[model samples]
Target: MSMSGEDDGPADSGLAPEGVTNDLVELLFFAYRDFVGDPDRMLAEYGFGRAHHRVLHFVYHYPGLTIAELLDILRITKQSLNRVLKDLIEQGHIVQKTGRSDRRQRLLYCSETGATLTAELTRVQVRRVARAIADPVADEPKGARDEHGFAAAQGFLMAMIEPEERAAVRSLMARRARSRR
Candidate 1:
C-alpha cells in the first residue's frame, strides 16, 4: 500500500512493496542455509569445509580448469585457495597438471576418488531437491508447470543481477547442465 502522506511516483519504482522484500530476503537466507546443511555435514566428515566442497564441485564439473579460472570463479585470495588446494591434493582427491600452453600454470582435475565423492554429494543434493519438489505436503502444485514456474523465477532473479556477473553465472550453469547430460 502506498503511504497516504507521501506522493508516490518514481521514488517507489525501484523498491519492492515494504514487507515483500524483507520476507523474500528471509526466505532466501533460510532456504540457502538448509540447502547447504547436508553438504556441510558430509564435508565435515571428510575433514573438508565449504571451500573444499566448492573447489571439488567445480573441478569435477570442469576437469582441467586452470588455477586462474578457479580463482576467478571462487573470488578468493590465493593464500586461502592454496590452503584448500593443498589439503585436497594431499588427500588424493584432486590432481594438478602442468598446463600444456604454459608450463608454469597449474590446471586442476578431480581425481577418480574426487569424482566419486563429487558424484555422491551431487546425488544427495539432487535427491533432496527432487523430494522437496515432489512433496505434496509443501502445497506446491505437482508437475511440470510447477517446475517451469520455478525455472522462470530463477531466470527472473538472474536477470536482475549485473550483466558481467550473469555471464559467469550462466557459464557455470551451462557447464553443470552439460555435465549432467
Candidate 2:
C-alpha cells in the first residue's frame, strides 16, 4: 500500500518497499543457520570449520577448479585462502596440481578423504533443501509449480544476487549443470 493508504498493486520494480524486508532478512539468517548446523558439527570433529567445509565442498564438486576461481567463489583474500588451502593440503583432504598451461596456476581437487566428507555433508544439506522445497503449496497458484520444484527457490536466490554478477555466477556454475547430464 502507498503512504496514502491505497493498494499499490504488485511491486514490479523488483524492489520491495522500504523497511519491508526485515522478515525476509530474518528468514534467510535463520534458514542458513539451521542449514549449516549439521555440517558444522561434523566438521568440528575434524578440527575444521566453515572455511574448510566450503573449500572441500567446491573442490569435490568442481574437480580441477583453479585457485583463482575458488578465491572468486569464496570471495576471500588469497592470504585467507592460503591458510585453509595449506591445512587441507597438509591433512590430505585436497590436492593441488599445477595448471597444464600455466605452471604457476594451482588447480584444486578433493582427495578421497575430502570427497567422502563432502558427500556426507552434501547429503545432509540436500535433504534439508528437499524438505523445504517440498513444503505444501496446495494453496499456491497452479501456474507456480515447476517440474523439479526448484524454479521458485532458484529464482529467488538468483534474484538476491547483485544483478551485474549474476551472469558470471552462472558461468562459474555451468559445469555443475553440464555434469548432471
Candidate 3:
C-alpha cells in the first residue's frame, strides 16, 4: 500500500523508522545509569541516595540556597526536602543560618564536612564522565561531533523537559540571586 502522510510510513519521510525514538530512549536510560554508576556506589556507602546527591550538588553550586529554592531545584515537596535537609544538618554536612534581614527565612550552607563530601562526590562524577569519553566502547565515534549527533542528542534531551519544570528551575535561580545579599 502507498503512504499518504509522513507519519503513516518512514519510507517517504526523513524521520527514522517507527521504533527509532525507542532506540534513543533506551540509549539515554542506560547511558545515564552508567554515567552515575561510580557515584551511586559511593553514595550508597555513605547511606545517601540520588536525592541527597542532587541536593549537595546544587547547594555546592549555589552556596546559599533557601528551603523554597532547594525545593524547586529538586522538584520535590517541602516535606520530602525537609527530610533530606534534616539528615544532612544532623550529620554535620550542612548548616542552616537564619537570614539577617528576614530572620524567619533560613539559608542553607555547606559545612566544612559538607564541602568535603561534595568534593568527593564531584570527583566520582568527573572520573566517570572522563572515562566514558575515553572508553573504546563509548567514546564518540570518529565523526560524531562533525555529524552533529552529540549536539542533537543534547538538544533533544533539553526539549523533553516540560515547560513548567523549566519555569520552576528559573524561579529557583532567581531565589539564589536574591539570597546572595
Candidate 4:
C-alpha cells in the first residue's frame, strides 16, 4: 500500500498494481501451512522440526551431499545447521563419511533408521499431492499437468526458483536423478 491509502504496487515495477498477486501469495502460504502440518507434528514427536525434515529429505535424496553443499542448498548458516546436523548424527539418523577422493570432505548419508522416517514422512505428503493432482473434480487445475499429466509440476517448481539458482538446482537434481536410475 502507498501512503496515499491505495493498494497499488510500487511505481515503475511491472507487478500487478491492483494487488492481484496477493491472492496467489496467500494461497501459497495456506498451501504450505497444510502441506507441512502433518510432518511438523510428526517431527515434533521426535523432538525435531522442519530443519530436521529438510536435512533428512535432502541427504536421503542426494547421498554424498557435502556440508558446504547442504548449507548452500538450504541457504542456512553453519551455526543454525550445526545444531540440527549434530542432532541427526547423534540420533543415528545420518552418517558422515570421508569423501572417497577428498578425504577432508564429509559426505552426508541417511542411516536405515532415517530412511524409514523419511519414507513415512514422504508417504504422508505424497498421498496429499496425489489427491490434489488426480483431476478429481470439474474445477481442478489442469494446466499444471503436462502431457500424460506428469512432469510439469516439477517444471512449475523449478520456475519458481531464483533465475540464477535454477541452473544449479537443475544440475543438483540431474545428478540425483541419474543416481536413482
Residue-level error in angstroms, candidate 3, position 118: 1.2
lDDT of 1 by residue, 1-181 (tens): 5454654332355433433333335434544665677789999999899999999999999998998899999999989999999999999999999999999989899989999998888887776566545532221234363422443444334433333454565565556547656
TM-score of each: 0.66, 0.67, 0.66, 0.66
Please report, as a residue range, the 10-residue window in candidate 3 with the lowest summed lDDT: 154-163
lDDT of 3 by residue, 1-181 (tens): 5475547364655454434344356446555665566567878988988788888888887887888888887889998988888888899988889988888888888899888989898987776555544432322234443242543553333233332343553354456546656
Candidate lDDT scores, in order, read 0.70, 0.71, 0.67, 0.72
lDDT of 4 by residue, 14-78 (tens): 44432223323433454566678778999999999999999999998899999999999999999
TM-score of 1: 0.66
Worst lDDT run of 10 residues, candidate 1, spans: 134-143
Tell me, by lDDT, which candidate is best.
4
TM-score of 2: 0.67
Q: lDDT tens digits, residues 107-143, model 2?
A: 8988898898899999988876766556522222555
What candidate 4 gets wrong by more than 4 Å, as runs, is 1-20, 136-181
For candidate 4, the 10 contiguous residues with the lowest summed lDDT are 17-26
